[model samples]
Target chain A: MIHNLPPGLIMILGALLLPLLGQRLSAWGALVLSSLSLFAFWTTPDFHTVTLNLFGQDLSIVRIDRWSWIFGLVFHLAAITASIYALHVKDTKQHVAGMIYAGSAIAACCAGDLITLFVCWELTAVSSVFLIWANGTETAYRSGMRYLIIQVTSGVLLLSGAIIHFQQTGSLVFENFLGLEPGQRGAISDLGFGPLLILIAFGIKGAFPLLHNWLQDSYPNGTATGTVFLSAFTTKLAIYSLARGFAGLEELIWIGCAMTLFPIVFAVIENDLRRVLAYSLNNQLGFMVVGIGIGTELALNGTAAHAFCHIIYKSLLFMSMGAVLVRVGTTKATELGGLHKSMPFTTVFCMIGGGAIAGFPLLSGFVSKSMIISAAGHEQMFAVWIVLLIASAGVMEHSGIKIPFFAFFAHDSGKRVKEAPWNMLTAMAIASFCCIAIGVYYQPLYDMLPFETHYEPYTAAHVIMQLQLLLFAALAFVFLMKANLYPAEIRSTNLDTDWVYRRLLPRLFAYIGKLVRLVDSLFRVACLAMIKRFLNWLSKSCSAQGWLGSTWSTSSMAFWAAVLLGVFLILYYL
Target chain B: MKTKDDNSKGGNSSSDASWLERNVNVVIAGLVIACIGSLIAQLWWAPLFAEKHVEASHVEASHDDGTHDETSHDEHAHGESSHDGASHLHPAEFAVEEVFGFEAMFGFAAFVAVVFLGTGLRLVIMRDEDYYDS
Candidate 1:
């Protein structure tokens, strides 16, 4: 019974004990425990669920719903794959942090109230930083710190909103909160603020514009296995949270539109395969966020299904890059080529993942991605739909084709290397298969929708349109390449939004520091000059020839002291 | 057509053959079939799976608007209306139903199985351990 044994308690117990086991066993053991817990939750009868009260609030610590189940299932599966992938890793800190990070996401999904969500939310922030730190490079360390600061700030906002909402409404139910009531300014001033706070919290995790710098900054810098874990949980969790909290909020449509557009152009020119995928991840989240914004039963279903499929496909893409990096010692498209000769298996998996991401006619992405695109159309948001269609073409260019085309099949770099490790390949294979399975037979995904919609994804028109998009995009790539108009892969940095923090902000701080130092020095000189001037006056005044000469200095001192004391007495009395 | 150096550079190509040799049509076909097959199966399974979920909730409560407009109008015209209150759920009695339950779990299991089996097959065929790095 989950009620009798709350999963959070089990998780806390596991988090505490797992680290005590030796390094090798700790990660694997924690993963096994999480999987077992998932099984326990799954087998436990829905009618016989548990409730627990913590901190003067009764909450459903083991609630079962389509939303929670979707997140929980992926979290557990991701944990298993991550643990297996990290088996060769010797970093105990990363391993422990990963387990804690994943456990928190699962715990959050199971949380019934805002209070519970806040606790798990903060926990996820604290644990995930180690993944970035696991890179053990200066860039990674700095990026990890930035990630922690943003994530914690997001949590703080959510917590503040939650506390305010509770004080105003006298309840802490996390779901279906329609912001602050009007005309009341006690705690929660507006409904918009509550969703805003939660949206910002999710935006950082979801990698929304402005708040998304951390993903591009930190993901590529993490260890391969850590990146795999990074890909699976945090952003997707935020999308789930947004879907739960901010569905049908119209502003999200524009926000989603912006998110969908910005990443593709960046991905088109990006050098690092992982960074490209990071941008693609942002693009994918845009689709889900748009779905949340649309808030139709079909759209929400699309969001959930997209999250599910996105996790697998993105991870597959990352794993392929990881595999390439394993052999070639780099993931830069410019530096990598002819990998297909030695790593044919990884290439095959990558192409599958690429196809899925590009929304190829019969891949997982097609099934879920179409739902959001259609929702936009259904809502008569013709502009958003058109942009999304353009972005879909960009997805294929940057991810579906470019990633593999450059890394594995471009001008051969003449580097001969072996395939990825068995474990690594195994994980990639699993993820790639899911990417395709979701597309080919989308009915299972459609039926799992929380709301019923009669639209079919496989209608001839939909498939034809999608195929045309992919074909035309491929043709465009060929046309550009033939014309030498396509951007050539270069061995240099391509700036992302993170450039704000990475370059501009730090430079701004340094410039401010320099200006402050100059002002400080100038003030010191001016103070010295003022002291000299005062001394010159004092010398004349205190000398025998001066008005207040040494002959009369004692009387002058006494007079001044008496006047100052009198003034002080008056001021003190007043 | 160009410089001697350019001709030498062009002739000394070692990377081109490996990529062309590696495409090996058979590998591409296998990947296509596996990916397409699983996607179709999952698509077919989603809706039937979701329908099973809707059946579980015991009640689909809908309160009918039983009072006709003429009757309400007559009562209102006679000034016979007495009660005036907004319908609200009791906080203690409010319950939220799980709209879609095992549907996600079923989908997840199917996803995991399909991925593992497909990748496992690919690994068997590829044979080389470091298939991705090269």
Candidate 2:
């Protein structure tokens, strides 16, 4: 029965126990439970499935395949690493929420049916919001609400899409929607509304193009360690879902291109280093989306490989920035500088992460990202290939140079802080090691791909070309800096898509509320004036000495009664 | 007397500041040197290595095809080349492989474009930190 149990159940159940256990015990419990789930994933045979008949439909709760395996394994790894990093946190609520969020993402990855996917998906949205709220600031509270609304909206879309798809096809089985044969691509217009809705749902989570505002809006506001966990799971899960359900959809190519391109601009102007990382995270997802859109064996492999590598390096970068936030109490670029003199290990780890993200040679990104670009070239999509090439350099600008440069090597801010704690250092070291290992010895990663990977990453030409791109980008940074053409880091907020929701929508609602209040008061005053006039008339006519109030009232009343009775009798007779 | 003391203090602090500046300059110079070295290595050494590998893979692929008939050999070679072109693991043949410093030039151009693009965007959307505080 334990073997047959869903892989994520252990973590969810473990989360429930976190409150009962002491803080130290709960942290240990998270690591153990996460490792146990990882062990379960590995031990579970390929194509191993557990089906439950619920509501007259067979729901696949545990569908173990190569695709799900990679995502589930990475989720478990992220959970363990994040738990380790958060060991210093005393807040039990964060611990519980983090474990549950990781569990839900894992459950979603393994979910074989749309209904199951939707349930786990919503659980992830619900549980992850607690991580944001754990900051216990007003801004964090507001951002958490916004994050929750967007996430839950994604879940609602997924549910609606699932229902529509089920009604149309009479099946809830989650699989690729396009029904394209291998090597075939599908156009966006060819998609039904149901799948398109689901794609949009994934798009929101994946931080796709314009729908990506929630990420930059909320991620920087999360607790230091919570952001680390947040960075690893949610968007990557969306990418996994997209690769699973909508691979080879050509529209994703342009969407992916826009996703990669637009964030670079925002990241360049972003003051918060963590927010910069969030934009960088969006840019990285673009590469994966482009791969998924390409929908070839190599491209799909690239998507999977990139996701695996991105989770490691991105987590490492977040952990480094998180360490900075924890030590210095701010990740604002204006406030940080020359941290390497103090937090040397973190800087090194961050540099390694930056190098990997920039796709420098002998780093994980160089190995994984080339697959997609190579796929584009082979397909002769010249425009997309060129855009990707440009985006590659753009990634180097923010994540590669700007992040490490401003945070660690720029003007010293005179704040000397101690290095990060052992637990955090260990987590970062593990992630950094993975980044280097995947870059240098990528054969294992390639072999683990869902499809057979024929591409090699360590080619002389590929390595040189990538080095040329990265180094020349670095050279541009030098030139710009010498010329003072690079934008100066300033403490300011830049308007992004979230501005519509965070500012404009609230103002609009307040204005409407004022109008409603004005109308209500006017209506009340008019009614009150009418009532006053009626009262005045009544007092004047009916008071003593007015009209029939005098001595003649008696005679008038009797005569009126007699006449009324006579009329009534006549009408009754008639 | 007070002014003299203040001047001495200022001089001492300035000296300390200069020391820090010197150390920072040294670090920057070292990094710049390393970057330039990498550029040189990429230009000089990488192409040679690439040529060797490309030739080796080409020979191996051709040998595999030689066992087949002429018609199938051509087809297999075409498939192999296409496969290599698409595969991430393999170094795909580029149309301008012989073009020296193409990646470097392209990278520089991309960086300039991205920076200009970012600056232009900032002009339109930049706001005070308190823009959202209200």
Candidate 3:
């Protein structure tokens, strides 16, 4: 509202001015602009809305409430840190794209109406693709293409759903589709067709189970710095959208459970450390989705809180990997080892990020993730609680133990590289600081929740259990290492759901094309053979020397004439 | 690979190996201590940490106590984790969450199982680095 415009639009429009700032200074310009937008967002009064009447319908362009505020503030933080991280890059396009993408996501969360949300949603898709393409690899470009298609398809679904929703409800206000208030439970059956489509739209963006391949597919393909940006906004925005629109939807619990469970296994075999982080990202999102599904005040608070903390720590993890990628030219676990010998600071940062993700005590993940698990326990969903517990152990296995263990401390690949750039280090340090700060002093974060909560994260039982879970998981790693039961880090591509499109479906279509060609060739060959046989017979029959066309007809006629005369003579004698 | 690694541009070209690499045993020892410490901590904190006797805790509690030898909590100053009549599927005086080393063992077992599953998963899903491209 600094210029009586949406805070996100401010960053988006201000991004235009960034190119004028020149390549060298544009990154700093972005940092400044996001900070400005954050300040403007901070000053916005609670529940403020800017509605525009458009063609007989009210289009709410901007709305600032508790939900958007928290998301917006975190988006701003991400933008500033990402901008700082990208300061070493002279590419103006990445900066511009980064700002616009982050801005649109912020705008999308703040959007009061579905139309506005849809516009920003598409903007996020269009703008963010450049980050992947900036890698300048064929793999990255193709991955970006797939990413754009899926994201644009999500946007299309959102728009179509919005139009239908308007027809049915005569309002495009983004609210609970089931018309349930926060903390009120509802079933998926209660939703209209529009809401279901909208849920899918959110689900695609949210990386919901089967719809999740794009996240693991594209994120690892992005530029080193760009993946850090990619990790922060898109899925969390979907989590926010789902929380706003589909909270308490009963089916989300199972979907979230599935979302959490599979990624850890995929992460285990994944050779690309970046892809491992991507899978880990999906797994983390599952916890937030489950929180939103539970639809209790504490659970919702957990979702919001987890989202906030996740953006920082996940960004930190990605940043650390990006550092590795920048220095060593690969984040392949097989190629990366004994990095602590050279890049000790980077190694430390990576471990901190890993520890944060694994929900070590007094780390950001611990404080935030527990809320969701406790909510599950509070609901007494024993199976779900147990699954979540297993997932936690899985998280420890992959992100906590494997990422740090293999990347920094395992057998010496003997690659000696410098520490990350000052700007990158600063960004990681800032994010790391935020992780610890939030973990220790969480009340301020708790205050930003949409609902009131006295949910405590530091209970004696909770801490001990979490410690036991994590520490023993670490011990298991040691045991596995000692017994040589741990899987060796091998250079390989691990199959995931993306196999459907990237491999299976494309191969299916290719086979289909081959089958069509096979059939067509066989038919043509058979027809030609038949035609040749017919012509040969026709030629044989029409030839002058052939029996049918020859003078043998005359001989047969003479014999018939003699026989007829003999018969006549006989008749006369009788 | 070694040739590529030889391009050590900056930051401690002097050190051939890190202290961590030299003292891997020390790190492992620390982890072992932490694991043992966590189990010991559970035993100590079980009394003060016992929360409500959540109804569902009994099911897992009873199952856990079935392997009573593995579970480290026999000295139940509080009743929640006690194996006597309290560990039955019936409503316990305390929650099953207080079961000493239960989470620890579960975490250890689950981690091993997940890693083994991952190793097995490699048989089905792992492919050459350019599997998709090829």
Candidate 4:
């Protein structure tokens, strides 16, 4: 019966009990719930729908299929690993918020209808903000608020899009929008405005191009352990939504292309190593998006597989950086270097993550990412293929080279710190093992994909070509570094698109406030002057010294009354 | 060997220096050899596998159904060819995949372009940490 419950509810309900439990018990409970969810995911029959009748409309609260199953599995895995990483954290609120956040993402993944999905979607936005707040810094608080507003806006769009779609189609069963037929001219032209709104909603969460600043802004500012959880879920869930709703939509190819290319530039010069990884995370998502855009069996398989591997490795990267943040009190590349000497285990783990992300010959990225690139080549998308190739090298530069090189192996910053805690190292080790296991023996991963593909990743040609690209990219890094052409990390903030909201709008509001205050004071001054003049006239004419205020008031009153009466008589006669 | 106490004192111990300091040449040499070996293998061995894979994939495509058969013998045979020049033959495939050494060049060029362009953008957008504070 417990297994029969919606998988996400187990975590959500379990989170409610977290505060009452001891710290150790809460951590263990979080892991247990996540593992139970994974078990539920496996046992739940494919395409099995659990429906409830509400207001004469059927709502599918849980739908287990290969697509949702993959996402559910990864979400649980993220929850477990992130929970393990955060085991040392004294903050119970973060544990509760994290569990709830992970639960909401899993719920959204399994929801069979748009309404259920919308509810879970908003829940994710509401719950995840606490992770940001857990940092207890003023900057974190502000960033968390901005993150909430954007996430809620995304949920609103999803709700509106769902309503309009249901009205038009007379159904709310969640599936790919019928208008998103393969090889369509454009998503907007084909689906009209309704699905476009939904797409933009996912795009905002997905960190698509200009809608991406929320990720870079808030992710780094979360509590050290909190960011590992933050890194895994939100964008990946959005990717799942896009895969579910808009696969094979050709426009996504270009959008995904842009996503891959733009982040590299920002990540290159970013001083905060966590922010660099955040940008790297964006670049990684691009490959999945492109796969969804292509929408072939192989491409979809690539997307699912890449998402799985990316969750582990990206979190591992985050975990290592988090360890650095915990021990050294900073994650800035400008401040961190030669950390590997003190934190050798973390160094090895970071390298594994970096290698996995860079698509080295025996890593998860090689097995997964090549599928998307190969899919592009097979589709004759030469332009996208070229951009992807370039982005691959770009990935090597930032995630592969810059992250480890700067944090652990570059100039010795001379700040010796203890190795990461056992729990953190253990979590990183598990993730590192996964990165290698999935890379070398990929059959298990392939079996779990949404589609059956016989695509072989480790071809002699593929391996050699990938090696050539990665090694050559490495060479370029060395050349640049030796020549001093590489950008030096500095303690500064780079203005991103968030500047529009965080800086420009607030300053504009302040300027308007000043103008309004000036006008208000002027109006007050004029009104006071008129009152003063009126008082002066009163004193001059009607005060004790004036004629009206003199002792002859009775005679004047009589005279005025007589004159008024005479005038009234004359007018009446006329 | 340095004791744990020495590490905890947060002194600028020489041990904190990167592994690259002592082994930079060996690492660089090893990487160079790996790159050259990849180039050699790509030219010498990969083409033969590529041809076999192309032919094998062609056969598989003819009998292709929607469902993937994991135990299919031909699929395993095709797996040896690597990722490039596989069965989902499109007319306008990447020309670089057919040529040897082009990927390395392209990768190097891409790295340069990305770094150069990124550096240019940095000049425009880079600001002090308190840019928003004022």
Best by TM-score: 3
Measured against the true two-chain complex, the DockQ scores of the candidates, in the order shown, are 0.02, 0.26, 0.27, 0.30
Candidate 2 chain A, run of 10 with poorest lDDT: A545-554
Please provide TM-scores computed only on chain A for all of the candidate models, following their numbering. 0.89, 0.91, 0.94, 0.90
If ranked by lDDT, best first, what sequence of candidates would result? Answer: 4, 2, 3, 1
Task: Point out where model 3 deviates above 4 Å.
Answer: A1-3, A546-548, A551-574, B2-15, B54-95
lDDT of 4 by residue, A224-283 (tens): 989999999999999999988998888888899999999999999999999999999999
Q: lDDT tens digits, residues A1-574, model 1?
A: 4545644455556767776778777767766766776776667554344567777688766665777777777777777777776766667787778888887888787677787788888988888898888788777887789889988998998888887777777777777554412111111233555555766677777888877878887788878888988898889889888877777676677788889877776676667889889988998889888778767665777788888888888888888898887677778776776688789899899999999988887788887787777666545465777667766766877787789899887666666689888878887777776777778777676665555444456643345445545654554555455567566765456555666675679789999999999999999999999999999999988888888664655787899899999999999999
Model 2 misplaced regions, further than 4 Å: A513-574, B1-98
lDDT per residue, candidate 2, A306-369, as tens digits? 9999999999999999999999999998887777778889999999999999998889999889
Q: Measured by TM-score, how close is model 1 to the native structure?
A: 0.76
TM-score of each candidate structure, all chains considered together: 0.76, 0.86, 0.89, 0.87
Off by over 4 Å in 4: A179-186, A516-574, B1-12, B15-19, B49-92
Candidate 2 lDDT over B1-134, as tens digits, reads 14355355435544445343557567667656766765676666544534433443443432232222222211111122255432222344455543667677888889988988888888889999888886
Tell me, by DockQ, which candidate is best: 4
Worst 10 residues of 4 chain A by lDDT: A179-188
lDDT of the structure predicted as candidate 1? 0.68
State the displacement of the C-alpha of residue A196, model 3, in Å, after optimal TM-score superposition: 1.4
Instruction: Score each candidate by Cα lDDT.
Output: 0.68, 0.84, 0.83, 0.84
